[model samples]
Target chain A: MASFIDFRNPPGSDRRADNAVRATAEPRWVRRTLIGIVLGFFALFLFLPLAVVFQGALAKGSGVLIQAFTDHDILHSVQMTLVVALIAVPANTAFGIAAAWAVTRYRFTGRALLMALIDLPLWVSPVIGGLIYVLLYGRRGYFGPWLSAHDIRIIFALPGMVMATTFVTFPFVARSLIPLMQAQGVEEEEAALTLGAGGFQILRRITLPKIRWGLFYGVILCNARAMGEFGAVSVVSAKISGKTNTMPLEIERLYNDYLFPQAFAVAAALALLALLTLVLKTLTEFENARQLEASRRVTLETTIEPPSAA
Target chain B: MAHKKHVLPGFGISLGWSVTWVSLLVILPLAALAGKTAAGGWHHFWETVTDPEVVATYRVSFGISLIAALINGIFGFLAAWIFVRYEFPGRRLLEAATDLPFALPTAVAGIALTALYSPNEWIGKWLEPHGIKVAFAPLGVLIAMIFIGFPFVVRAVQPVIADLSADVEEAAACLGASRWQTIRRVILPPLLPAILTGVIMSYGRAVGEYGSIVFISGNIPFQTEITPLMIVQKLEQYDYTGAAALGFTMLAASLVIVLIGNRLQAWGNRFRKHA
Candidate 1:
């Protein structure tokens, strides 16, 4: 029942473990030399192919690169991507704040199931998410007959893209908010309620301030995921180039057609976006991971407040 | 901050809210798929689901995912081990770089891997000389899966390894146990649970993975086609029923895998406690 080996004892085969360390430690002076070697591997593995595509795009020189940015099709796709993220992220954040408040603050039937359901999108491929919409709203889909009777254009349309993106990205906001709410607990909410503040007032005055940073964090991630979403968008979009293509789908199209340069330019842009979002996520993740820290902050606030009145 | 003298139960409201979201987010989409498949009637649905090419594609995807997950599990663990046990120069950089897969778009990852390992490229050229066809082959699918899946295992195992106190390993050595024996008997047992968690997570991710695989897979029907890819293909054909049917099937299979993987994780945790 106890640990198989206690840490109280010295490490076994000190000589061998040390030897192992030494063996790996070789090229320490050569480490910087190998920095390129390792980064070369990563660059070769991660960046080079993208670079190759970018280079191919640049084959026509700076003119093509400029042309890529100004191209109507590329511009439309870029604009559409920004529009979706801008719209979806804030809407999702509002939804998430409410959902996180409800789920964490209240114990209800099917709570666990809801938690599981929220994670479903992360598990299901985005492609499936896309197809689900088509099955539901496409011409002959489940509700397709009814919706079509109403002249509703659900598939191969912008609205459809937005809806699918929303569904696929439905999890992030709530997920990000849940841990924060869970960590913060309801002491503050209770305090506000006792002060005669209504639910909405308490939420605005107390809850929002506590979790504004977390909400912002969630929004950033939701935006990143929304912007980069490919399989689902690719599936639903008509591949109408300038009309429907997001950056990801555009990259896929160019790569598929061996238009490496244009493809990589977009891919490079995506990589840059991914890098930016990653930095943001890291900052939020640091904030999120400190479960105790949030609680400690809450505790500190309460400690500084007046003791409960008679 | 609101301090409640007494708060009324808000179960109904929260429950209603949760059901609304779940219905909209998860159940509705899937139900529509199932409904569509069922609308075709069982006979037609059976025929569609059993299409030989469709079945073959499913097999290729499943088989390649298994292969890729296994490969990643092995190297992923070793990479985790090297990163955990050995602290040399550039350690933090390497550790940070391990998360590159998380940052890299799957599509970008696919192209990068394909370019690097394709038969014509510098690395792929050597691989081709060895008659190992990558890019646009099943092998390429495995490579992408491995690339994307590596981070899961490494990330999962790293924290657990860090939490392991050096005292236990020292105790094993004090018993005159060899380093290998200590690692196998003492270290490996506890690590198995975390390792299994990583493996299952990676497997699930690999199974659902699309962006990364599509590029390298060449999307060859009946060859390198993945389940998710197949769903997309079906949707492309306007075979809404078939796509939903396949999606439901994959959903069920993955759900089962996840449940079983969870049980294994629980069992592993029990072992760690008992160990």
Candidate 2:
């Protein structure tokens, strides 16, 4: 109990008394000093490596880094990355919202197994996912002949690359949106139906506003992962240098050829963007909590159970 | 998602849509790998998977991933602790830095780390006489794995750490417990589940990671080569059957890891319920 008061009443207050007795009397200082050393350890273990990468990236002048951005291959990579993210993220978002709604709004059989199957890609290695696409659509893939007969090129091509990315990253938004929708309570929608709000109107007016933050969070995550994907992209894309190479593939090529500065600089930009997304993620929750809580209270107020009059 | 998707008849419809998409796009390809591997017949498939190069790559990949995940587990915990417990200059920046591995293309992360730690580089020069090389070696693979893997642990543990009531620890201190004792008895026990969960996830991610590791790992067979690299090599050989064989082998191992992960998660959920 005495230790309790000393520990919690304040910090750095009574520690001096322990210090006075510490000379020749205790190695408690050693243990406490070890706690102080934790900071140094954190810097070495976590921050130092990251700092090294950052330093390597910035060692080249901004002009050089920016110039790398316009080099035709780098630009092609960037353009392809953005093009894919632009297309894939929105597609996933729409899929996510529709899927989130379905999962949360309805009750039916086979739902349990279906949820597991949806989560399958998350468990499947990205490399394996690429191989799977190859298997399904490659020259000897099950449908390869069918696809080729139609003059459809899905492997070693842009369409193939995009399809691979889309499959691997599909679940990000739906997983994010489903829980938020579930918690918002289904009763309000029931009330909306009683008032003849119609399905689409209820969604636009009610659900979209409520789940927007979650959706935003999901979309940002989806975009980041989509932009950064490598293994799946590597497998299916043929990595045709200027044509199919994205930032990640470009990084590998540059490094393979020993172009260190340029590669790090490009990577640094993507890392910076990802870091920004996480910061947004932290901000999102507080904003989401406040919005959801406010609307939830509103929902409860209108929950009069249809006012049964005998 | 704010409004109920009231139009759908049941959860089955959405689940069906999601499953069908992930299945056709994700699973069917994998199933094709299986089909192709089968095409090679058992003897040839076994030979392809167990080829010295292929097995060596898996050994290096698994070995480095295990080491990196362990290292990241320790530091990732500390980073999470700092993010949750401390307020300091650049705290938010550090928190954001942890996500670098996730956002930055793995290719970039691999390259940046390689440049920084390459033998002739700034930090490496200091350790060169002592003979530590960071780039284009097995160690570089470990370094890259650490970079791309830490975010999983940090992000997984951060929220749970934040939601942990500080009062519980305070109460332990209010008793006669030493700070260490309080942390062990009061703090670490609840944290173990989350930490373990994070560790398992990061381990799984590192096991499968290809891009970040590829640039730094030198891709030297019997040294820094990884399983994914082996798969790529097979494709390069125009030995599609061999590539399919190797890919299926790794796919099987990853599924085992995934199943183990699911079991760990289920156990954690049960423990949470009991707690």
Kindly list the per-residue Cα lDDT of model 1 for residues B184-224, writing each as its tens digit.
87788788888888888788888888898888888887788
Best by DockQ: 2
Provide DockQ values for all models, in the order shown: 0.40, 0.42
lDDT of 2 by residue, A46-127 (tens): 5665566567667777877877777899889889999888888888887787778767777656566656666766766687
lDDT over C-alpha atoms for residue B138 of model 1? 87
Candidate 1, A162-216: lDDT as tens digits: 8778877878889878987887778878877778887778778888888877887
Off by over 4 Å in 2: A1-11, A14-63, A292-310, B1-16, B162-175
Clashes of each: 23, 4
Q: Residue B230 of model 1: what lDDT?
A: 71
Docking class of 2: acceptable
Cα displacement (Å) at residue B172, model 2: 5.0
Compared with the true structure, the alpha-carbon lDDT of candidate 2 equals: 0.73
Clashing pairs in 2: A132-B29, A132-B30, A207-B2, A207-B3
Q: Model 1, stretches more than 4 Å misplaced?
A: A1-60, A289-291, A297-310, B1-18, B82-85, B268-275
